[model samples]
Target chain A: MARINSAAQLEKVRKDIVLKKDPNKPCIAICGGIGCLGGREDLIRAFEKEIKKQKLEGKVDVRVTGCHGFCAQGPNIVIYPEEICYTKVKPEDAQQIISETVVGKTIVDRLVYIDPNTGEKAVHQSEIPFYKKQVRNILGMNPKIDPKSIDDYLAIGGYSSLAKALLEMKPQEVLEEVKKANLRGRGGGGFPAGLKWETARNAPAELKYVICNGHEGEPGAYMDRAIFQGNPHLIIEGLIIGGYAIGAKQGFIYTRHDMPRLRENIDIALEAAREHGFIGNDILGSGFDFDIEVHLDVGIFVSGEASALMRSIEGKAPEPRPKYTRTAVKGIWERPSNLNNVETWANVPQIIGKGADWYLGIGSEGSKGTKMISLSGNIVNSGVVEVPFGTSLKEIVYDIGGGIPNGKKLKAIHFGAAMGGSLPAELIDTPLDFDVMSKLGAAIGAGGLFVMDEDTSMVEMNRFFLEFLADESCGKCVPCREGIRQMLRILTRMSMGKGKEGDIEALEELCEVGSLASLCALGKTTSSPIYSSLRYFRNEYEASIEDKGCTV
Target chain B: MSDILLTIDGKEVRAKEGMTVLNAAQSSGIFIPTLCHHEKLEPYGGCRICTVEVESRGRTNYVASCLYPVEKNLVVRTRSEKIDKIRKVLIELLLAHAPDSPQLLEMAKEYGAKSVRFGKEPSFCVLCGLCVRYCAEVKKKNAIAFVDQGPKREINFIPEIASKECWNCKECFPLCPTSYLQAAYVLTQGLVGFKNS
Candidate 1:
């Protein structure tokens, strides 16, 4: 494997790789994401040994790629360009992957992702509804492009957007275009992208910076981490464009240290970008010199907050500053900074390639793009889903997510991780966008969709989210520090079947104080799950309050 | 920065651009009950405990004050018996899961809570944003966020691995008034309405 040192050399190598497709040989790609890594690495090794045992080394290319996103059906394997998806593969089946599929070029009926509704085994990845609804602007190229391999990314028109940006578009135009597209920050806050960029781009400063909020501290939220694992280059390209638009030369990707594979993949992507002159000083012969450095998040939930994240990057305690001073104006050692989540940055290339109006045509009027939600919790096909914004909850839960697994009735669903609200089965028709979710007392915070079955107790659910918020709160203010303490107690007594009049009123008053006086979003919305759960399922709370026992 | 003025609970409050109705209310000494919220962390909007009746831009309904940004003509009601009742019931259920915390007991007393009206036993640790927010925002370590989602949401170290990264700093423990912080809040106010065992 010769190194493509320059852009010209990289272009030539990519062209050669694109033209040279080995029809005679079969290419096997196994999902190497975190979920699949559970004994799947051993399976990969076994597959390699089996391939070598058959003496089909050169003829067969066995590669371990990133997540295929149907996590509940992992360790997933797909063969291309045929794209035959094999689900729940074991080490013992390594021979079948090599013998039946590799040699016979046939599909393994038993291992395929069977559509639960149709009872039909999906031969190709596209046939599955999980992939059917997803546009895959970012993930579409991931299956073919090896995250660690620079040539693979280049082969699939990887840095072409960066090239186009550097050559054709100015920084301000890029910002305006993204803003025109109404691209909202995917990191919980539904702030307009253009406004954030404009604030930072025009901030009073000689030096400005851009940060990619890869610190996905939300529970069950792994969409950004998966993106970093699958298509690191796309995120890089987005960051590069963001840096150019914000007039920032230096950028940082604040990631959680828990994801070692993601960290490594990103490092490789950065190296690849730098080596090809797509990321470093004077990128692609353009005078604009933008480079990105990876900063490991201390791996705490609250650090996902922009202020805390910025503080961590500065090697200080990750405490959040008052929002009265926006981080965009003074952040990351007091420089005008623009920060966006991994998904937000990843959408830049698409917005640039296709005009904002063209991008807006994909989803609802307000949310004019696709959102990749990491759907988990009691679902049959728990995985990452990228659906148009306007897709209803029913469609997301049943159509794309394959509904609750093991024949359990859907009881509740939680959007936006722990901080986001939970909805009852009645609200299943709610649209799967930011605005619609808010109407139902929820928000699309960092794109995590979790399903709950009948077995789950709403009282227990309320306790669980509060427990999380209590642990995550920074305790900087009295209301959050004290209010959550008091609320937790009342909830504890209620769940224990201990009946006391006015307990509900007490909890409500405390919640009011916390919401009224707390300084940050953490304190404000921490009570969302309990409210939604109580509102929709008051009977559940009543059952526990009256009965004094776990119903399920 | 230019300041915007608004009235919360009839008290004049000054906030900058992008401030939420809740922030203005809190600054004006208005009390709005919330559980999943934390001052030092991000707004999750999951708990819905911070709901308040807000009249702004020609709409009046219970809004999650934490998520609703402030506006010039916004009117917020932070305290109401209806909200108080809902919060008390919600907290009673929360207490059933973590009844030992003195802090919670004391808080329950503030709301005139005597005992939980539902559930059977205390599970320890209420769903507050202290540990998760502190671990992430203050500690810069997402080693422990809410690991599972929905009814399964709980704090767990990332990868569920037993490593020094977790350190059991108990930095998160102190925030859990039921398990670590003061537990009197639960004993007093929260337990007022609870059915005696």
Candidate 2:
């Protein structure tokens, strides 16, 4: 493989890869994402052995690709150009899949996704209701490309944005395009990404840095993991573009150490990007030098905070300092640095490749583009969903998520994690725009949407979040460390039917102090769950206090 | 360096550029309560006792005065009803942890924090991170660090370096408000004795 030297050479290579590939050929794309790979490593081996035994090795193109988003059905396989999707596929079923679907073009009835409401069996991937509603700009390529192979990415027009940005547009123009797109930080803050870039670009520092925050420590969130494992080149491309936009030559990807598959895939993708001349020195002959170093977090949740992340990168204990000076001005060894979450960085290419107006035409007024939601808990179809920003919660929970399992009534939807709050079942029609959700006291934080059913206890849920926050807090400031500890004690006692008179008032006081006085977002937003729960479900707390038992 | 003029508690103060609110307040003879702040060491905003309401550019924010840089035309209220209430609550919370510490007790009295509302655990260490910061910043030993997170967060000696470096170096012992460091050292040394036995 020759290194791509210029934008014209990259375009030539893309054309060659596209022209050489046969679209009409029988290709098997097995869902090798983390969700599908659970207890299904044998499926890949079975397909390999059967293909070899049947003398269909080269004739049938078998590739293991990333997630397909509809993870309720595991070990999913999609046969293309026909787009036939098979779900709940087993190792033994690979033989029939190869002989019947690949060779004979016969549809497998048992493996197709059956719609619960219509009693209809969907044959193709696009026909499924979960994928039907989603406008997957970034995740749409997950089913097409093998993550380890850069050729597949190039064939699918992966780094075309980098080429367009480097060859055609100047750095200021690229930054202006992103600014015009009105892209906010998807890492839960919703701060304008354009302004952040401008600050880092204009700061009086000879050396600047860009970081990708992939350490998604939220309990139910796995969208970052899916994007990193499934489509690593997209992230790498976005990071390189961000490095160029911010005038930084060095970048870092800070991810959690637990996801080994994501780590492996990212490692491969970075090395491939470097070898292909997208990462290291004089990228695409544009004279912009940028490279990324992958740093695994130290397993603390607060380490994902921007300042604390920089501190961890500097080889110190990950504690957040007061942000009198924004991290964009002075970060990472006192140099201007730009750090964005994985999803936020992934959205950059589309804004640059396609016009900013094109990207802004999708979502609501304030927020632009689509958001990747990690739908989990009691939902019928629990996985990742990429939806437009203004999509209502009812549409997501009922339509895309397949509603509650076992015909249970939707009790509450916990948006975000401990830092974000929950909304009652009555507010299901709330649109998922950042301002709209935050107006209702719940945030679209990092896209963690956890659904609860009728049998769930609101007090218990609040206590569970408090316990999580208590465990994940960095214990830096007094209000966070002591305030969270005191609130947890009161909530634990109330959950156990030992409620004092002023427990509610005490919890409110703690929330006030924690929100006002705590240093970092972790401590500042830790009281969100408690405050919103107490607002909506005061009866639950009252029941535990007065009746000495939970009503639910 | 340029001089930044600010008003703290309705008194005009002239501060140099990059000077913190606490330094500016102290330079102009204004008193502010603090627990984890040390002039000889870098500012650790863990205790949050010196939080003040500062209005700049028409936005009011409660910031830790020790770390927040003084800006020109910034209006700082060192003592207000809301500020006093938050400070009192913080002192009460600290009293629950270090009930016997003379420094914490004095602060509680000064802030008029009459009662310990939460159940007292009577711990000696307040989790102020002063010792941890001092060891890492001033001494450059990094022998001690905060482990775990949230409520279970506690200061512990790094096992790899603790045994080799911390026995004779008692530099952070005096910085701790309570005798928790001496007690922890004795207990760890007792564990070492048990290992030998």
Candidate 3:
């Protein structure tokens, strides 16, 4: 339990930890992510009990890991060395799994994912269509590492970026490398992370701060929980590296209050990092000292907005202020605070560990490297997907998501929640680039991609988003609060077949006020769904108005 | 403070650094409508009535004149086709709440805001936060603040404090853009007067 004094010592520790573990040993890693853990909390216990009953103690490891990302096939377990992935596993199957698969080393055909059309069984996790196409640089270790154990992270080269940033690279050099990579922020805006770092680093401040926006409150998005809960040290490592680059001595992780497990995992990871000297004073013999504190969000959608998130950190109400003064220059007690989403922070290690050129080689123009999108809503494979930028919507919808369920025709793809827009099925050929999607009017806000089937009413879908925005709006700004209410009322009446004349024009005017004048991004993009829906599905609005009754 | 030269409605104006566009415009006798702004309180950017088309760093965006700081070479158009349209809608939306506020009606007259376009759902409180901001920023009494959010958002006086402090000082009452604040304060008073006895 000695502190890692130097980079060499850290490397030696990693080697020693790697040497102690057997790579070929039988390990049963379960998907303990929130969505997959539907009464399967005792799956770990069941496996351990079955392993003991078979007297296979010490031979078999029953490790409860974070999300495997194939959540539609819930209660998933992967038996390792063979990388055998089993889905929809029951507690009763634990006995057979230990006796047959662990002892006999045979595949469990009944539990393995079968290609629905072909009926061909996919044995390994990598072989499955969902995992085959995904670039799992961030979440690839989810099935291997135990989140509670820092050694699990270290064994797989976790804190090496922090070590390299501290010992090898200068703070300015590290900042330059991130800038060179053009690592865009994954937290909604896709602002260049390095530019933000340079500002925070150069801003005159005796004290500054860096924050990880773990408040993934964007409706159906759960990628933050997937990777963060899977490997807490990944974000911790990235945050420390960011802290070193940004010249900040302190960091804060502002996450959701509703998810206790996500916060608990982050807490355990921080304590482990502190004990190992990866976070505390003079990390890895480098004179630079930085530490992070975890803070719970106010549990609202706007609380995830950068300004409001900082206000909550300052123990104030999570209402957003205008960003005329960027949070990077003035934030959190008026100190320069650089805040990036958890996914953005998670990508920092890869950029730093590998060269900027190597990181830059992964994705398309303007956007560099992979993006973790939380795929949900009428899709066959409802899970977390990490794909490189420029991956076509068709690829994601069909290859990764396994297409729409129940032979339903694809209606539209809604990216982001409430504050984002919807794309019709015809635009499935579009790339997942920052500029391309925003140009199409559908922003990749927090990477929540909801697939709507033919049965899905575009009007009802848009109404749902507006209702959510109306409910979640902080009501500080008149344009956002009153605008959303008025728009929602018109849409509500339209849905119930009471659409009056000029309702469309009234909604459009309110939308203009929302986008043009509202104080923050939440207000600025409040009309996104409305605008996008009205653009593509104006006929749906007219249909509802023309005595079609409630289309939903 | 040093002077920052900027163009307001095509007129060159010298404003002190750290001064807002609203302050700069008002000093130059330019008319920019605002509802939630107060000289004594902090810039709350809530009303969006003072929103102007500001061109900075080759990008033009709509920002509240009350909150956006004056920068060098900033082009401020207090009145533009888009800015006027946005203000008209913002006024119309606020009118849905406080349809009869003298302050809103005056701006509506200027902007030609049509309130009948939107359905009537009068909660009366425009959520300008003037009364709340006045109580907290000016009085430092923390007597009243906004409670709840979105459509349900309202200015509520803390019964414990308003019962004692408000009887002597009804300072925030005059700051309310609508009579809703007085109605809210009266309701809180009745509740508190009953509780105290």
Clashes of each: 157, 1, 0
Ranking by TM-score: 3, 2, 1
- Listed per prediction, chain B TM-scores read 0.75, 0.90, 0.92
Candidate 3 whole-model C-alpha lDDT, 0 to 1? 0.87
**CAPRI grade of model 2:** high
Better of 1 and 3 by DockQ: 3
lDDT of 1 by residue, A1-552 (tens): 543334565567668877886655578888877545656779889988998999988778887787778787788788876778888888899898788887877777788877777887778888887888787777666667678887777777777777667777888788889889999888887899889999999899988889998888888898887777888888899998989988999999998888788888899888877777787677767677888988987656778788878889899867666554578898989898888999999899888877788898988878878888999898877888788888898988988888888888999888886678888898888887787787787788888988999898777777777788777887554456456666676677667766366666666666665565455677767777767766787776666665555465
Interface RMSD of each: 10.1, 0.7, 0.9
Q: For model 1, what is the error of residue A146's alpha carbon versus the real structure, in angstroms, after optimal superposition?
A: 1.4
Instruction: After the best TM-score superposition of candidate 1, give how far the Cα of residue A43 lies from its true spot, in angstroms.
Output: 1.5
Docking class of 1: incorrect
Angstrom error at residue A399, model 3: 1.5
lDDT of 2 by residue, A1-552 (tens): 667889889989999988888889888898887655767689988999999988987888888888878788777889988989999899999889888888889998888889989999899878899889888888888998999999999988889999888878899998999999999999998999999999999999999999999999988988887887899999999999988888999999999888788898999999999899999888898888888999988888989999999999988878887778988999999999899999999999889889898998999999889999999999988988899999999999999999999978998999888888889999998988999989888888999999999898877887888888887888878899899888888888888877788899888888998899999989999999888888888888887784567687
| TM-score of every model versus the real structure | 0.76, 0.96, 0.97
Q: lDDT, candidate 3, residue A59?
A: 90
For model 3, residues A1-552, the per-residue Cα lDDT tens digits are: 889999899999999999999998899999899555657877888999998899889999988889888888888898887878899999989988888898899877799889886788899887788988989888888988999999999998979988888889999999999999999999898899999999998889899999999988888999998999889999999999999998899999988888887778888998999999988899998988998999997768899998999999999999998889888999999999999999999999988899899998898988989999889999999989899999999999999999999999999999988888899999999999999999899989889999999898877777788888877999888888888888888888887778877788777887877888888999999899989999998888877774556555
Best by DockQ: 3
Candidate 3 deviant stretches above 4 angstroms: A546-552, B180-197
Against the true structure, whose TM-score is highest?
3
What would the TM-score be for candidate 1 when compared with the true structure?
A: 0.76
For every candidate, how close is chain A to the native chain A in TM-score? 0.95, 0.98, 0.98
* Residue A27's lDDT in candidate 1: 81
Better of 1 and 3 by TM-score: 3
